[model samples]
Target: MVDRKKSPKKTRNLEESRKEILEAAFWEIFTRSFQGVSVDDIVGKTSLTKGAFYHQFPTKLDLGYALVDEVIKPMTYSRWIDPLKEYENPIEGILAQLKNLIGKAKPSELRYGCPLNNLVQEMAPVDKGFKERLENALNYWIDGMEKELKRAKEGGYLKKDVNTRQAAHFVVMAHEGFYGMLKALDDPKAFDALYDSLKRYFATIRS
Candidate 1:
């Protein structure tokens, strides 16, 4: 009789399967709110079966948690955190990253708003687990920004009186608000206005 079991090379690795599910879940949750997308919807987006999904993620909530931790956190770090290290003036780095993101944003991204902000609006209030995980992600971003802003202050790039912590929080809140406005207005012009306004805000804190 022929062997029915899959060969080692053909069998999907745990990490690969988990990553597939996370990527599918990321888009599903990004386009549709986390509460809006179902397990079937997420699985359907992937090549994997429901059994395979369950094997990788015991529960849909578990999958959501993993998505936030693995995908969203890293994305936040890359876009907002890591790039700051490349510039001596964190203010310039912040503005450059924002400009880059705005310049590259697709229509759908503007329409949908930010994924992290979307989840914060959709899931944070209703679910404690989600609220904690999402807040942790936000805090991570805030902490990174705070560190950079502190460095800027020490480097004399920011006003000596500027509170780095508050500045970081404001930057994050303003960033989220910019996306929120874009999502609500569905107009690309709003980005230019917001970008200009953010530039002005940064000017106020400059040394």
Candidate 2:
């Protein structure tokens, strides 16, 4: 007879573990504001152990920063920035992206609100690190929009007097505000009304 000992379970690789933690934290933070969810709450959602979590993210704050850099930044680029490249008129691109987002949005998303906006409201004021990271993400979005708007202006798709920088900022503000209102009202009709109003606004800026 051989002495029998239990075999230790194989652990996930570092990148895989890190990704799991970030994904779990993202959903938790998205639904329940970042301040509302504890580290345990995030870890509980993943199969990884506390040690595994710490190995990937030294602190909860670090995890939040990583979440913004890794998940939110890429998401913003993919959803808002990349789509604008396809249209000569940035206004048309912006409207098309908004329509696609509204068409594909889930009830939970409408209820929880935009993830980047949620973090900005919750963490930006109190935490310096969060403020910097969130500000950078917002600037990335604004810069991308500004670049496209500039292109449109050069191509004569936008009004001669249109200020691309200010217009880009306004678009970001309105886009974030749209989700905030939806989250507050929990009304689909509000989305349709707001969308139509945005279309009218876009028309005013076009050549």
- The lDDT per prediction is 0.89, 0.88
Candidate 1 residues 1-207, lDDT tens each?
A: 756475554455767888899999999899988889899999999888999999988998899888888999889888998999999988899888877886468877688888899989988888888899999999999999999999999999999999999999999998899889988988878888888988898889889
Worst 10 residues of 1 by lDDT: 3-12
The lowest-lDDT stretch of 10 consecutive residues in candidate 2 is 3-12
Instruction: Give the top-scoring candidate (TM-score).
Output: 1
1-207, model 2: which lDDT tens digit per residue?
A: 643342222233667788889999999999888889999999999998998898888899999999999999889889998989998777788888887896458777688888999999989999999999999999999999999999999999889899989999999998998889988988867888888888888789888
User: What stretches of model 1 exceed 4 Å from their correct place?
Assistant: 1-12
> Which residue pairs in candidate 1 collide?
none
Error of 2 at 174 (Å): 0.7
